[model samples]
Target: MTLADHHHDTSPSRPTGLGALGRPAEVRTHPLDMTSTAEVDAVRTALADAGLLGETVRFAFFAPEEPPKSDVLAAAPVDRRFRAVLLDLATGRSTDNVVSATSGDVVSTRELDPATEGQPPIIDAEFELIEDILNVDAGWLAALAARGIEPASVRAVPLSAGVYDYPGEVGRRIVRAFGFQQDHERDHPWAHPIDGLVAYVDLTARTVDRVIDAGITPVPTASGNFDDPAYVGPDRETLKPIEITQPEGPSFTVEGNHLTWQNWDLRFGFNEREGLTLHQIGFDGRPIVYRASIAEMVVPYADPAPVRFWQNYFDCGEYMFARYANSLKLGCDCLGEIHYADAVLADDLGNPVTISNAICMHEEDFGVLWKHADMFAGSAETRRQRRMVISFFTTIGNYDYGFYWYLYLDGSIELEAKLTGVVFTAAADSEYATQVAPGVMAPYHQHLFSARLDMTVDGVGNAVEEVEAERIPMGPGNEYGNAFRQKRTRLTSESQAQRSADGSVSRAWHIVNPSVQNSLGGTVGYALLPEGQATLLADDASSIHDRATFATRHLWVTRYDPAERYPAGDFVNQNPGGAGLPAWVAADRPLDGEDVVVWHTFGTTHFPRPEDWPVMPVEHTGFRLKPVGFFDRNPTLDVPPSRGGHCS
Candidate 1:
């Protein structure tokens, strides 16, 4: 059936028993009281303005009745004590509270769809809207209170649908409470929280009591002590005994020997101003030679008698002797000059004697010295006086993974530079604003900037593998890409504009340099051309220059090199150096072309204060380099950095 045809008449039959008994038979209905007075007027004005309250309109209120008794022979009387009023808009009879208390009867039927055109049913939609509006009002009310305001903890529960029986009065109450009018087509933003929930006015704090009676639990306090009880009733089942053990000593004794002047030799040859003393000897019976001063002065010695010590030593004499012999033979000083005399000596019968000098050394110092010796022995060109080197300097924050330096070495002209750390931008923090144009300052104001360098080595004009590397941020404010924001600035001017026929279109450009210092006022590094002219390059240009433009890009840092201009143990104040620039080289090596300078910096950008512990995050920064133009165009560029490999 069509929508209009589905409308069923629900008028109640005339009363019987009450009129027959002559019990003051006046039928009347009372008006439904709206929570607010303003809502009633608003509904009246709205209905009148919409032309729904004139001759063609009619409004009525009804309370549903109980089912009839089975034994009744006569029709039961309508419950006239339950009153309702019908409005005949045609006669303009719209008086307030005009219904008398003696009318009751309502029609009931199956539910019908409410989406009919030109005549949408208001039952479900109106109740739903009222509920939502009430919820929003409650939220606003809580917000207005001086205390007990909890935005996250607020909630709403609907009461009943019977309150909508007086639509006109109900509508007025809602309008007065929320300062808005109800319209099927227009939605108000303030009404969002109240939608689809029942509205209730708790004049006597009855709402809370009603809610409790309906079996809802109250919300727990946010700061209630939940941990105290938990600790008092700790579970013993989860406890277990912990075992401790004492640290054991070394497996064997570390024996050492000393060299004497007897292992020296005098040389008298042509053009010899002073005789050069030499020591010829054997290491565990293996022949070796060393300078007399190095042999006599560099070896360690103890006070114990040699034969007595050897006899009194613990078991495993052979193993101990072998370890001692191997360690002594391999030991060398910072210059890579092996002291063979310490491991060898003159035999009693004119044959070379073998001496043992083996002692455990600190891992860090030993590593440094070992590398120094290896680099010196491998390259003959750097055997003479070492040249001064230049290095890069940067302070990375504590959270940084590490720094990277880009170096270009082609067995010819070498150049080096570095880029700062990496920062990542998250979508949650990024927003699109209608007020600002896309790709403008507003979009990138807090955006993070990072660089990825891909270097390829070409061999015989053919492209080989490419090496990819990334630098990441290291300190506080790193979580939101703030670290990058502090070190770089986006060019928002027309300088980054692209030329068009009509005019110029603005394009975003990232310019990176040490000029953009962090709050600490210390910059990462400076850039200079081959001619020593300094200039800041665009981010893309910097990447390309570091990758393939230069013959060799040296990634150096300014570090305190104690051996550069002072004795081994001389004290020097920490400074950038007199010249403000110096050659960058690994600590263990002499500055030379044979070794590619891999630079690193170590220091605090800002001095620590008493408040900094438990060691606040410090800013540290550095760079990395891949061989771009270093080889013949492109070689095996995909090789990863070696864990134990030195540049030389």
Candidate 2:
């Protein structure tokens, strides 16, 4: 019988509702929610009316602060307010802090003030201007001709040329060109190479600063090797679309910016800073995490040569991830019945611009969640696993990072970061570029990213516990030395919480609410289960190390402070280093049974390989926040088996 044929049977495995069981009374549009296109345009008009428009002044979102956000979520009446950062780009730039603006009327007027130079949002217009310049570069065409390559055969991609402080330059629109081959009219232009040719353009001077043309290296060509037909397995050439059918329709509901799926509920919003943020996260109508987002990321290059020493990149702080958001396509980046979300941004003229399909939410069949077969009972039981995925992707220059938040059937939450796209390669000297190529070295680098998790486990008074499996001596209790004991240690303060991942022991950290207990007398909590290679390998004294001290350890718990958002202070591009996580944690604040924030750092050290040339395959790293004693029993045990029957 088909899966749907057995729907009439009232089996234990059959799910009742295809959508939310109940709606939360307090659930509504978040005030800190991303500024709408209409609101953005209105704000722009208001700023102009106030004489705040100039070439030297730029706009950032006026988001709601923590107090207002908390008040609104608590169902308490709050005045509608918004905050934004205005960057002063004038020469000399004597200002010590970022220009701040607040608006009581989101549509009309705003009050401006200067405050502690917090993390600044990137200039969106600059990237648009770069794209315009590269599309019509005569100099680039001539350079390609000089190298005996036709213009049509090459595809030039504009990359943000990092600031190195050249002699006497202002309003400088710096961009470098990386060319790809378009042999055989294929869409995979990343197959070929343009060697190492650099170009600098000044918008103010309206001139090309310099064109450094290096020696020509053999073009790395790829036409048939990586395409669909050849890349497929033997005898696997049919291109039929695999469909995911939800017989009862989707188990989710989206009303405005808020979404409810099964036992989980959350609000999603976008901004020109951190891209996507999940707010007011709840499970089974109870609050869990107040807010969760990717706070900041730093990708530091190891080569210290003059040409590459200053290659450290603070992606979230410097360029801002929102500017690089990719408009994902269906059946490519995601599958199933996809629900798309659009984002509104400002154009070069401070007008509203809409990016469609910027975010996608869908349900995925996550294989088998739980199964048990007993020969004595002559019975087999299993339930198909399912998960809800909320994802958005951003392509920052040469690399692409996909941010995903998953809600599992068993009350577990996972945050995943997927790294893909082309590697940042440089022209190498006669010294070997290793096995990849003769004159190209994909410099070794580390990508360290941290997520700000404001967790409220059954209200705000929560404590952290570090539990480890320790091996004891044989003399203890006159027992065998083979036995390992469970050691539970309470992290009473921030100083004790700032620690590294001890791989030698089987350990876990839990954010627990002592006031809430399960039937077993265990505290209600969620455990932080760290995964992947998360520690930063850089030296302690380096600039990268100093700025990203948050990366030194796998996890850190601190008392919640609104100002302490980003771990790598705000001005990360060529920063002097003395802000972000290290500065915040240096105070050693109390963390027990108070509103606390958890910072998780994870990453990888990439050493480029030959196959990694052109475009590298995607590599992933992430962690999970699983329910520990939060539930009285195994929640998934009651999940009904699939009507399609068991797989034997």
Candidate 3:
């Protein structure tokens, strides 16, 4: 049933929900929202008492329970359960478990398969142990000594271990390590990249498996310092401070996980797996997206050098995307009246670790939404545009990514990924890279992100169609031919839905409700407008191509399954070929008017320029979701004109 027609009952959810990480004094726990810190503690205690959690068990992911869409939409009495992916450090076995927060009873438990499925994410403790493992390795020390670098003078940066010709590490947990010549404590380690050295550190054994030294490349001596006044000179004094004040407070209200602004209502959630997700996104009490999030993201470096050839990092699946979220500050990170939600996630030891002020929510003004000047009537009408922004920033290795989800007044949704950070550099020069600094080359790479939209257009019955603008043939029995029409091909199956974006044709995918019709008798739908860029650039035979099959296309639609969450399978660490999206679509399930989930791959193909040296400028890549026949008219027509927002 459509929210507009079904009394649009929220759980009294006009306010935003609080996350489980931790909470302020004013915030209260919402059961259907994110898991509470108390819930985490209680669940962990229950598992340990029940012998489900041993000392060797580490938590790869722990967060609030996701109630079935049926129970949620049907408004069933949902139980409070927390889901977890616990890893046995001794045997490297990943177990998926569900425990009730109230009764402390195990709801379900199953051991996962790393060969057929995927490996669990690399826990934080493994990353913390890289330097220790590297320091004790004689092979790694010999390689560093070959480059005239000592153990104390260099830093070992932990990196994602990509799949390659490593038979010894088939079933073991491993993390790649790169050497950086660090001259001092304050000196930037990224500036002095000691190229030709690699360490395959096994986390299970707590030792460096082996070292791959291609050859000694000259280590760059130049400094890439952005903080020091000596290198950066002085702060810009010419710029004026821009202060934003909400005189009457923000338009959005947050009560626990629920967020409501104007006619839009939704609940926000955070976890150690996929950072921020919106649940039950409804506009004007009409359901649009039941859940939405960046399921997985892959950063494939194009450098083919032997030392760096296998450098594709699955940031979410392998690195734990939410674990490294930046604690946002008030003035620097955000402006205006902001409501911050903390994300309490389990650490490696299954203990609650709080990331305070991780999620930032605020409102912004965007020029004009609608304007018309009827000169015949000698009058004009214009209305301002505003959006509620829910965002979080994650600092992963050499890069920091800002995931921002904006809900506009025009009933449009946008997910913009703000990329700004230090580029990964190497000492050797290569054609597949850009020389950002003297003797240092930054590899040309692409950041491909996949957004999984588990859509509930009106209810559960939804369909997708690929719409393209096409020009009619001039020979179509016309003396003067200037006609063009839209070609909308309904996607009926998973194989047919594996599509790409074509900007030349102005292509877009619309998710429509086959059962719901608008006032014009057209189907009520939402359009996925892509900011089309190059997809995966690697050859079809490449390792990353097979592992990251989802990045090879623009759109993939599959019948909704509760277990099919991650795009590139669950365990991304050392994932083999044909495990994720490609494997899931082997059945080619029917998508015509079924419970379908849309996976949209969009990204930025970055070729670093000289200006992108130390700290790169923010590069943006995203897609927009706009209403199509979902409303009777301009929904913003009732929006009041901004007070004194125009000239006389």
The best candidate in terms of TM-score:
3
Model 3 over residues 143-211: C-alpha lDDT tens digits? Answer: 887877888887777777777777776767777889788888888789999898898887778888878
What TM-score, over all chains together, does every model reach? Answer: 0.14, 0.80, 0.93
lDDT of 2 by residue, 465-516 (tens): 8877898778867476687888988888888888676757867788899788
Select the stronger candidate by lDDT from 1 and 2.
2
98: Cα error in model 2, Å: 11
Give each prediction's root-mean-square deviation over alpha carbons.
43.2, 9.4, 6.5
For residue 357, model 2's alpha carbon misses the true position, in angstroms, by 1.4
- Kindly indicate the candidate among 2 and 3 with the higher TM-score: 3
Candidate 1 segments exceeding 4 Å error: 1-570, 573-613, 617-620, 632-648
Which candidate, 1 or 3, would have the higher lDDT against the true structure? Answer: 3
- After TM-score superposition, the amount by which residue 115's alpha carbon in candidate 2 deviates from its true location, in angstroms, is 15
- lDDT winner: 3
Provide the lowest-lDDT 10-residue window in model 1: 292-301
Q: Output the better candidate (1/3) by TM-score.
A: 3
Point out the worst 10-residue segment of candidate 3 by lDDT.
1-10
Residue 590 lDDT (model 2): 82
